[model samples]
Target chain A: MAKFKVLAAALGILLVLGAAAAQASGVITLEVEILPGFRISGPGSVSFGSLHPGIPEERELQLQVWSNVPWQLSANYYGTVEAPGIVEVQGRNGTWIELGSSTNLVIWDQPKTDPDGVVIKVPLRFTGSFSHDPGTYDIQIEFAVVPLL
Target chain B: MTRVILAMAVLLLVCCGQALASIAVAPVIIEADQVQAGQVFTVVCSHGGEEPLEVALSLALFDQDAWGRVILMEDEASVARAEEALSLERRRFLLQPGQSEAVQVQLAHADFQHLYAVLFLRPVRPGPSTRLAVLFLLSSGEGTPSLDLSGWEQRGTDLTITVENSGLCHGFWAGELLLFDGEGKLAEKVSVQSGVVLPGRSRGLQVSLPGWVQQVEVRSLQLGDGS
Candidate 1:
């Protein structure tokens, strides 16, 4: 009877130590890799077809942006515009801000995580006066997307 | 019947073309700490859409404004400095659908000062195209930085603190703010988001403060180890 009692106590201690050891090793560290993704796509051109004198012509272009991290979208013109015109981008509040010769920050630190991305509309307005030339006034605009850290 | 079939085929092609016209770039920001000369880094560019993409890579000096907006520097000296520090193996390349290209960038000079440059991947095709700007930050970790609280303002629940980096190297601000009431009692503790301040530049960090807070103090401010 004495031997049996000693054996029972030993087993109890062993079980307690085993449980403690198991609990210590049960902690898990989980990790996942999220590949950085940034993409942009839009139309090839915006045609403001045939301008008239003293009349304002407005055209809109839509751009799709996809990013997993914070991003900034900026626009700038490559060369001077012979015609008096202005380019504006639609803001979150539905307002438009003019884009200048220098880099203009259209969207700042906005993140779009969807795989399909989101579309943003940019509008360009120009009014040809009677004194202006009738020839084509090509204005080349460039759009750039940079990650904001 | 033949004409109808041809018209349908053309319409299908047009729809598919428009759907696949995107340019994708990965690892938008490349950072290195204690950088050494001749160290190489890689940036991958892929064409996610169906059309072939024509990409040209170039490096330019860049700086950030007080609000952290990136501004490309175009002065002669700035351009020359950027050109002397880094070089790319593949400046121009074409990527097909589902194909990617890795451009190798080798650092020629890693001075003690922090260097900021941008790799612009521009598309050759014209008319409203998208471009990707990848930022490279390199530091030798041999210089000390000076950070000072230049200004602060309160607007409703938001508290903006402007910090100036007057050192030769860039500094990162990451710490907590101790908000106290009018009686000098602790009101609330708020964490300030980490941001980079270039040398001789100031950056504004915005934090949320409790309405009853009267005084704000920076606590346990830790600067990054140039990493």
Candidate 2:
């Protein structure tokens, strides 16, 4: 009976040590500064000149985003526009989504592609209607890049 | 002659509109422990463009929705609470090309055990502009995190697991999903990316499974201190 008790105690100690080892290996410290740099750049303005009634005009703007961590891109317009227009951004899967007044996700969970940055071309289309007056109208769009924490 | 002049003016405007604005930030995520009054932290912001940039900094509280989308709090009460909790040394500044600034942030109140906020850096220029948002996670070091696997689902070869944190403090969880075959032998293993789960919130994480995977087991679930 004494020998059996000693064996059982030894087994319990081994199990406890094994569990501690596994937990230690799995715990990753969150304090490390892994992503130290993030950058985003684009043109100051895009001009779509002289829109004619019943005609749609298209222009492209290039944006570059660089980061050391996984990040997401979103865009939103500052004010409302009466004209019918669509702002489309190409994704990694070769698809485009319309960006509107509300914040819309353009790129989701994109990994770091380059050290400098990756250029993304955004196509803006404006369709004119006879109901709207002919004048110089400007709509400011803002792009935001945030790390996926 | 007037039409030709106007056309030349428009062409000149388009040619000069190629001004690019670039901004870079370091340490995108800031995690701290035991929040106290007058606690300080630093974030580095740099102007990577050719021209000068007028930068503005603001603070706002944020939360994650069911699909892991960050929603910035805009209500008056939430904004007031955030303002009362944190403050920046310089809210607006000017940065020249290749110039960097160290932003100083000070804590005023420790009203919650765990809090999340974002520091927004925006350029004061017109037209298409790009900005950056940095996340801050602060804790009082008083409570523990209780992470539980709420549920999971499989569709085709994709699997998603929902994890809920019902504790007083926030925590980051990570682990692996073990796949087995019909003979109960281990077929493959898929890693679960580490993500933060705020107090009283749940997060859905997607994992891809092999077609031959008949059984799945979540193993080595570990939670790290996110304060």
Candidate 3:
């Protein structure tokens, strides 16, 4: 009888731990059936260092992609620098593409290879103009990855 | 009838436990000291909760020494691609409960001859995601660290053991040591302190000795992954 009681008690504790973990996750996000795939990683932010007018500073933001299928990568300006001038986010695909509020283009597309997954490096040039006032100009851009199909 | 009830209860617990983490991944870190460039690999992460989860994959580079030592930056999303020639897996997906997903990571085009990346995971929220990392080690074998027992001293119930990393790489070790009293009887098992040690660095593990344990025997240490 005592052995059975111990087993029952241990089982009860395990159940409680499981229930508590479930509640912890439930309180965090939305309600949807979940699967896995699609993600983006960056250095939280991109800094162009100190720039001078007319002297374009060349920097690189390397983005890694891990999609099981062919995917298209796009970017949009989140908070535009409302200074006299905003920083232009440009990239190198087959040609030079300027990034702006409406210029969400597929700068880096995963090749239709066997795995269809890859990492891409985007070489960017940030130019500040003479009319642009400089304190510490900030620009926020959101990069998105979606299925190409 | 009692056995049936017990079996049913056990099944319920297993199901519920898996459901809790919703996102559980095995072999969290891909330690490939022997892995060469142009090698294609895959990682398997699963979902098991009642709710759907979105597991977004992201890649971050961790600068590692020649010994394949990588310090995972937890809770940090921004990873850079400078100084290292590795590419981490990045993507997002919606997963139903009881679903397993695999993502491929590459490290061929990396800058350094031997570099590593921290593959972090995030669950699209409403639910939760486990804070996990997988290390893509690009190096030749022979960088694994070796641990040596440097000193062992017992002061009362406290036993201080010194473990030194005497190799070119980092070492991770853990297990328990058997303590025997003067009467040649087993006193108790002291947890062999476990942690990672950088090359040539020494660490101390304080194991509690029950009563007066005169002899300590060391055996069966389960060495862990790239520390």
Candidate 4:
């Protein structure tokens, strides 16, 4: 009986040690990701206040960009509206600026460090010094963010 | 005596149950669409377990050899230390419980159209590791290769090992070789002649064996996209 008791206690100790070893080796692996993420939001559309023939108009819309890394923003206007005179939109995305038609303009772009929200004034201007047709110009501008990787 | 044994057995089972708990990684693959040079791809790694976790992050390549098997590329020193044109930030972190974190990876350069890279997340504590492969340029419209072993012929105590790669891009294969005698018993097991085969191309490897080789088998252990 004494011998049996000792053997059982030994088995019990072995079992406990084995369980502990297994526990020490158990690890949960989580998927990994790199840094630098951005959430571009605020102001769905850029709207001009009002327009007058032979008169220039300017309006500012707030475009906010939230970034996790160094980033730059660029914009391009689709040539959807075709009306008299010269219709060109001029503005700065954040710092880098391009002044032209059907061209992507680089606004305020350099590099970033953290995920912070920065708002920029996206201005729309229409210079109608020489008017050929007078009407409402419906334009669509697309915005994109480029991060320096 | 019987009671003591029964009690110990029950205690062991209870301990085993508690010891086996683990955390999980979601979307174990990072498949990017039409990625090119200087293109940035983002992936979100969500933690799914009862406890919060901390992990060490690293990169590796996963591949298979002549045999059909999935193996990590870093199992060997050559493939593990091979330089790649890749960039990433935040190498390690302590993730909050039940929270998903985002990681940004950029392909700085690619010698081939398609690239395969695995992001390894090893838990700081005891748990399983997640290997997520980022298949680059899959949107290049070309299909992945179907690598296989073909054309087995014997040459007087030697064997010709051939690998056929049928795809638009190249394939890398490496594994072990198993030799069997005429009696259908295992004879000798040797490391396979591993190498890269070009697309639509077949290459032969000559492996010398020790005795009369009645049967030969290949066990593909690693695989990856080759430039």
Candidate 5:
């Protein structure tokens, strides 16, 4: 009877340990969220903080796009600046263009090779391929889910 | 079954305790809108975490030497003036977790032009304290002194003339160029006639050597873009 009791206790401990381990091993889904109004300021090496009355400041818009789906991504950028300014999307494009200065904000589009209503579309992978200029802008990057159209 | 459940409960409680102490420094941000000439700009430092860190700050000015070399001004005169213009007061006695504080710095005649300063933040207590720090930079109008270079750069029997502008309201104009010789002597003073260079513009004596000269040494030079 004593031997049976000892065996029963040992079996109970083992079951408890197994259950705890299983709980710890459950899936951990990682996430990467975008900050809408990310900005960086400096009397930076360039820009000098003061645009000569008429000179426009060149800026880059960035967004944080992350996920845990282990899948691919496609992003598009669309926006406008108060003044007719030049904007170049880093990583996706190599050139910058001039946009309207007032409410008639300059529009942009990607893959079109030219400005198209201020909207842009880009393709990327799941592993953090954010906009090149990640920390220097005062604009929002609207990331739309580009489905298989 | 009762014994097994008790064992599992104890294990879960211990694991939870470990998770509670795993907090780390999330992120800290410092931002400012604009910095005006001879003015004070407010700076806000923020931390997104569960603990507070002590912050220390300082400021300086950046300029180029005569030879056009990048230099950071930290001499006693400049440093003292800078400290006076910049004032640091803890906006709040407590920097609650996920909170920030505002600091104000005034730009005076002493601290101007490409102002560069650093705001340091480090944990006052020991342990894994999420330290938050940042750098505050402001651009103000250049603080160049208004100097008069009259008969300053000239050499041998040269027509040396001296002209000086000492006030802040008026500056050197295009007609204010002077001619000097190899020696520190004024040769001829030609006032700028066409363009009106204001106080923030260039004004100096123009020296003209009538004959060939071996060497010229310039002195008493008040060289800067503004007053």
Candidate 6:
């Protein structure tokens, strides 16, 4: 009986240790990507806010970007377009919809080089009536990463 | 008694395994949208898991030679001692789990267009070394305008049209501006030069538009005006 009791205690300890080891080794990885000039809008709409001549339009592009891995992520729009009578707008309200308000923003951050990274996709839409003029416009994009909790 | 001894040995092995022969560390993540040149950037590093994790964080910049091969941009002969000898400058940090620490890095003299650095996170524990590659750009705000039609205006009988270069970059090289009427028909077209806007500057020119033209559409020769 004495020997059996000792064996039972030892077995219990072994099981506990095994459980702890398994728990320590479990981990998950995530990834994200964002193409600066890429837009997912529809036909009859030229992205980067250029209004062509004579087309009735209504569409929006929105994105919401966030990081799950203890990182603060954000979107920065540094591009420009110079065509008079054409309206342009962008900001970091966590909501970016080109047309209607509250259309649906996306979570941004998906760089091709970041494997084992978390990706949050945003909705990008475009709608416009080219009732103005036509010309080539300039667009700029810059992405940044901050490592803070 | 024999069974008990065997079980005890097994428990010891399991506990030893839990101690971690090597740690599995994750690379740090940073996100920013378009960093400006000569701007100061603060990066934060956070550790995973509960309880404070002890780690030694190190940073280094890659030095490339004239041929663009990786070389330690410095020589040891300049150092007084081996321990104090440095190839590239390095900064160290101590991070606690669930906590983030920020470090400031400058974008001075570094080409805002091509700048990338490497960050190393070495676990004090016997784990794998995790690393992060950081990239940034500096915008001098000196890019030329893709299209500028500032000189064309509607006058009484004669419309004066001027083609001006209104950008921070250099000249338009060679391009033509075509004017269209409100009816979507081509009206007047002219070539332009001599008006270029330097950084933080602007210029103007003049031209004449037909009396019958109501509204105007300006476009380039590479692809005429219709946005």
Write the residue-wise lDDT of candidate 4 on B1-227 in tens digits: 43222221000010001122223333344444446767776666555445566755666554443332223454455234323656677777776757777666677665555555555444444211222233222324355655677666776778777778777665656667788888988888888743555456676667887776778877776665643
**Deviation from native of the Cα of residue B193 in model 3, angstroms:** 8.1
Q: Give each prediction's DockQ, rounded to 2 decimals.
A: 0.22, 0.19, 0.01, 0.01, 0.01, 0.01
| Residue pairs that clash (backbone atoms under 3 angstroms), model 2 | B32-B227
Predicted structure 5, TM vs. truth? 0.25
Docking quality tier of model 4: incorrect
State the C-alpha lDDT per candidate. Answer: 0.71, 0.72, 0.52, 0.50, 0.32, 0.34
**lDDT, residue B135, model 2:** 80
RMSD of each: 8.1, 13.0, 22.2, 26.3, 32.1, 28.7
Give residue A121's lDDT in candidate 3 (0 to 100): 68
Residue-level lDDT of model 3, residues B1-227, one tens digit each, is 43222221000011111223335554444555666666766777776457677777776654322222233332234355521344445578777878888777665553333444556555654321223445554545546677777677777778777776666555566667888989988877766644555555676666777667788776547655443
Estimated TM-score for each candidate: 0.77, 0.78, 0.42, 0.33, 0.25, 0.25
What candidate 3 gets wrong by more than 4 Å, as runs, is A1-149, B1-21, B60-71, B74-78, B81-83, B109-117, B126-130, B135-138, B142-144, B172-201, B215-227
Candidate 1 at B117: error in angstroms? 0.4
In candidate 6, stretches whose alpha carbon ends up further than 4 angstroms from where it belongs are: A1-149, B1-38, B54-90, B108-113, B120-122, B139-227
The residue-level lDDT of candidate 4 at B3 comes to 25
Q: Across residues B1-227, which tens digit of lDDT does each residue of candidate 5 receive?
A: 43222221000011001112111111221222234545655555544334454444444333322211123344566556556655555423345656666666555534344344433233333211111222333434343335454444555645343434443422332224345556756665544321112233333333455464434444343333322
Q: List the per-model TM-score of the A chain.
A: 0.64, 0.63, 0.61, 0.57, 0.25, 0.30
- RMSD, model 2, all Cα superposed? 13.0
Task: Specify the poorest-scoring 10-residue window by lDDT in model 1 chain B.
Answer: B7-16
Better of 2 and 5 by lDDT: 2
Q: What is the C-alpha lDDT profile of model 1 across B1-227, one tens digit per residue?
A: 43222221000010112444778787788877788999998888888777787788877878988877677765678768877999888779998888999888899988657888888888766443466888887777776667777777877668888877787777676778888898999877777754777778888877777778877877646666445
lDDT of 2 by residue, B1-227 (tens): 43322221011011113376778898778888788989987888898778888888877777876656566564577667777888989889999999999888899888778778878788876443566888888988887788777778877778888888888887867778888888999988877844778888898888878788888887647776664
Docking class of 5: incorrect
- Scored by lDDT, model 3 comes in at 0.52
The lDDT, on a scale of 0 to 1, for candidate 1 is: 0.71
lDDT of 2 by residue, A28-143 (tens): 66875365568887765676766565555667777788888777776665444532344455555656655565556666777776776887776655555455455566656667
Kindly report which residue pairs in candidate 1 clash with one another.
Answer: none
